[model samples]
Target: MKPWILGLTGGIGSGKSAVAQHFIDLGVHLVDADHAARWVVEPGKPALSKIVEHFGGELLQADGQLDRTALRKRIFANADDRRWLEALLHPLIGQEIMQYLARAQSPYAILVSPLLIESGQHTMTQRVLVVDAPEQLQIQRTMARDQSSDEQVQAILKAQASREERLRHADDVLLNDRDLAWLQSEVERLHHFYLSLRGGQV
Candidate 1:
């Protein structure tokens, strides 16, 4: 049988990476959709080739790497383009994640995706664990990390599931408004809780 899968998600800059890291440190296997997304789009990959076919070589640098900025701009401006791109990438990412989870050796494995809830990945998991912070905090963190303009940050936020929506769907929630020590404690607490969920023998 497939081991229990914990779906982890949050909005941009909600500290999901930090949360996931703690789970990793505690030995949970991680199947990251973000990594799969990047992998599937690597140069010469079929997904990348298809993306280039639809979006054009303008989205390719001279080195044949994806011009992510140009592609991001296009998808953000056009809803249809965004859907097409999602259709192309999401399945490939999901397939890779499934392969990783199938071999998971931990009490449970984490399926980490920014779009876990929005893209219906939560339904595939046994539990949904959300990392949450205030919307304003998300905006501030994203802007500082990405050097993104306020408008750009807001637009990315708008495209994601609302913070309230993510919380409402969560089987568990980690509030990430505090310091690293606090976050570490929360993850540790949840780590044991999950282990107990596997009958406390891990």
Candidate 2:
């Protein structure tokens, strides 16, 4: 039987990683789409070879690893290129996620993806949990953490689903604009709620 899954998502700098770690602390297995995405495009991976064939060797560094920053710039600058890259990578990432989830020993698993709703990965889960913060807060946090410029952050935000759209699809929302202690408390509450849900349904 398929294991129960909770899809977790948030925009960049929205504290999804912090919330995910709290769930990890409570013993839930996690499948991260970002990790899967990177895995699929690693040095020896078929996806990376295909990418090189399509975009040229300039997309790879001297170490043969993908030049992610270069690729990011290319895709974000062109909608068609972005769509093409997504079409190539999303299926591979989905396959990786499912394989990991199937092996999880935890009672329930969490699938974390920044593009969960946009990429249709939410369909794999029973529920969607969105971590939310104000747009300005997101920008500030991202700039601090990644050393990204204001324009770069703005471009990333433009690529993701709007904050309101994410909230609209959320089965649960973790408002992460406050301090860490409050966030941890909310995670604990949700952990119990999820456990209760499992008992009732399965």
Q: Kindly list the per-residue Cα lDDT of model 1 for residues 45-120, writing each as its tens digit.
A: 9988999899888999999889889999999899999999999887888888888888998878899999998888
TM-score each candidate.
0.87, 0.88
Candidate 2 scores a C-alpha RMSD against the true structure in Å of 2.3
**Model 1: lDDT of residue 156:** 88
On TM-score, the candidate that comes out on top is: 2
Prediction 1 global C-alpha lDDT: 0.88
Task: Provide the overall lDDT of each model, using Cα atoms, as 2-decimal numbers.
Answer: 0.88, 0.91
**lDDT per residue as tens, model 2, 102-152:** 997876789999999889998888889999998899999999999999999
Model 1 backbone overlap count = 0
The parts of candidate 2 lying over 4 Å away from their true place are 149-151, 199-202
